[model samples]
Target: MVTAARLGPEERARAWQDLGARELDVLVVGGGVTGAGVALDAATRGLRVAMVEQRDLASGTSSRSSKLFHGGLRYLEQMNFVLVREALKERELMLTRLAPHLVKPVKFLYPLKHRIWERPYVTAGLTLYDRMGGARSVPGHRQLTRTMARRIVPALKKDALTGALLYYDAQADDARHTMMVARTAASYGAAVLTSAKVEELLRAGERVVGARVTDVETGESHEVSARVVINCTGVWTDDVQEMAGGRGRFRVRASKGVHIVVPRDRINAEAGMILRTEKSVLFVIPWGTHWIIGTTDTDWDLDKAHPAASREDIDYILDHVNEVLSTPLTHDDIEGVYAGLRPLLAGESEASSQLSREHAVARPQPGLISIAGGKYTTYRVMAADAVDAAKEDLGPGVVDSVTENVPLVGAEGYQALANQVERLAREHGVPAWRVQHLLDRYGSLLTEVLHVAEGDSSLLQPVPGAEEYLRAELVYAVSHEGALHLDDLLARRTRISIESPDRGIVAARDTAELVAPVLGWDADRISDEVAAYEARVAAERESQSEGDDLTANAERLAAPDIRARAVGRALD
Candidate 1:
């Protein structure tokens, strides 16, 4: 198993220095799901690999997804059978074999608008969706009348539909899943680093060779040599290409998708729900303690890091979902809101909404291979294909990717541990539900976290406000997972940031204190970290209030990454 101790600031820097000073087979740009997957895919193939990201793993579109391991149902309407089949194959792989601990089946209720025709029409699409791509992972779809559907979703409006169709898919903690993919890559000897930004590309006679990477945290830069560099930067794919001093055969268009989170009780439902919008589709995905409802798809032309979701976007979601809810959720009921950009392969589209989800890979230059425009479900396949194309540049000695059967760090014997959840809880002196939650999040690796909590029973106490789980998770975030900042733990590591109405304000101080000992932070460090986190939350709240994206983006930038400013002061 890959220990959580690897890929710290020191270790990651050394890896980059060695690569810059020496040579490697492949260098992956972007630390989202695809880049992480490519790193693993290449490393397992007996090839030297390194992946670098400007921010944390899954920090971009990967973390902000709808969190489903689903076949693209909308793609069927587009007659994109191949894409749907391809994604469903990956979905089955994740649930049954690849990352069973991380991915599991989830059912959704599709409300039928028309009295008769829509039921069979939607049923046929879902039926075909269940059949394709070695789909042994999830159960088949079920048809339901309006009355029966209301029982499952009691809060759904009476007049909204004639009937509904219940169908299965899978959900995951996208940030955690993406991190595990990177950790699995590390276990296979891939040099994985975060907060490491590529300042420019290294070249050898017009061929892209490696990169000059800057350690954004430490204000240090190093050169890394490689035979082939793959661009997996998603929306930032074009940025990476520009850094390499040139163009590609294709361009990526940014499409912004926004999601809103509300407490589960806000809309009482036994299962998730799917609804149709005038221009696109919406989903209320079942997340623990809360439900995830979103997504507005439209052209995005501003800052990529923080894609602002305007008041209109929020209203658009609430308006559509309220159309079907008996007790509609208002703006005050929302717990959190997030926005992510889709890296669409730009082409002949009258509007960005009409763009395709299909990905494209190309060796635009002799030594650089770029892949862009695929869904989160098919990231692995995209990674494998990215590596396959890179083989042409690297030549012989590239072995076949062995990542398909490889389980992530937490996946080994997850089913057995799940079965023993009650016994484990008894042994650990915790509730069975608590054990189940840990096991779901960490699989067999839950023991590692529990062991720490056992050392100090204080760690057993839950966070101050968002008491859904234990304090040990915060410690585990720093000790086991690579959570450097307070935001990383609360926001991505455990999701206390989004789950609580205070946006983790009540929990941030406690979480920071828990991780401080492990990180060797003294009084000043803890204060700085805590203050930065509060500032971040404040900025986010301000951003959400703005009337539109432009004002929202401006508000968010108010809390710039002060780490850079800190480094500058130290240097001066």
Candidate 2:
């Protein structure tokens, strides 16, 4: 059996030692979906590759997306057919062949406001949407009368829509998927290290060669060499290019997108809704037990590590979504708000929403390759292109990328495990829904996660405040999923930070104590982690109440990063 790789503390220490042992074929700098994809692609193509990140995996924009895998429907309306077709093909691959256990189909209703030519116009666009890239894994679009639409969506006002067009798209937990990609790369013999910061680029005459990396936890530095260094750092592209001693071929701009989470019962709908906004579009995406309504697209120049969502941003989404809902939601209904920056390739467009989502790859120097500007759904294509561009530096004998045929770690026997959910739950003495939840999160690796609690069966019980997650999952995150801090376990590994009503404050101390022994945290360290996380949650709450971006950014800066605090490193 091809077993999945475990990225525990011991493996991380070995990766650091191996990083300085010899020259590598590829050194990828970033831990987002694109960077993880690059490592997996290079490793599967038989290249000696290593990926390093300053923080935990998916700690940046990769985790803060709208969580959809659709071929941007708005792009189709913009007449960018090529991008839509390519994205649709990737979406199909993820749903059917690549990560079926992670990605699943979801239905959305495009509510029409006009009684005239709107229906036929939308019908024509959706017909083309259905046929693009042979999207047959999910059902096609269906036209519905107003009554039929109301049958599924009773939350709509009586006169909100003249009719509706329901279509299918796919969604996944972006953070988990990105982490799995990194883990799968490690399984294929790629050295994956987190909390490692790149301080400088190594130069051999006029060409870039490698980098000087810092271990954020222990304040240790290492000089690592590689034949080619690929910069997959989105939104921070120019900073890395400057480190390379010259400006690259392209520039990246940060576009801020904000999303809010409310209880699922707040909007009584059987299916999600898509409404056209004046600037762009609003998606009422259905999360597990919550409805995610977002997002406002505007230019951001303040903070990149932590983007702040202001009162204005929240109000924009609430007002737009309320225009069609029977019950207008207020601030009291909101449970969570998050902001992310999209690294758009700088262009002449005055509005950030108008920028293209197509990715570009360039070899700025003889040994440096940079990839920027793309949607989350098409990361594999972007990674393949970046590695293909590196062939010039690698000389010959480098084979083509074969990641399209490689399934992520947990995807391999998922269907068979899913079929035995009832039996597994009965044997384990847990509820069937708990088994299904584990299956959705871990797929065929459900047994591996459960195995973390071998001696103590109580680890299978639900967490105290956040009942959706199991205590065993927290231990598994620390032991297998590379969760190094309290923030990583709550925010990325399980998503308790944004899913809970109190933003995971109630579960903070208990969770920290639970993972303290695994992380080798003394009592003082446990107190520091808990205090840092609480301060972070408080900062986010205060930032959301501010009226403008500048004030909100100031408010969010109150919380210091736990990993950065050890070394007293300044925020980039």
* Candidate whose TM-score is highest: 2
Q: What is the lDDT for 320 in model 1? A: 92
TM-score of 1: 0.97
Candidate 2: tens digits of C-alpha lDDT, residues 372-485: 999999999999999999999999998999989999988999999989999999988889999999988888998998988889988998888899999999999998999999
76-116 in candidate 1: lDDT tens per residue? 98889999998888888888788888998888999998975
lDDT against the true structure, each candidate: 0.85, 0.92
How does each model score on TM-score?
A: 0.97, 0.99
Off by over 4 Å in 2: 568-572
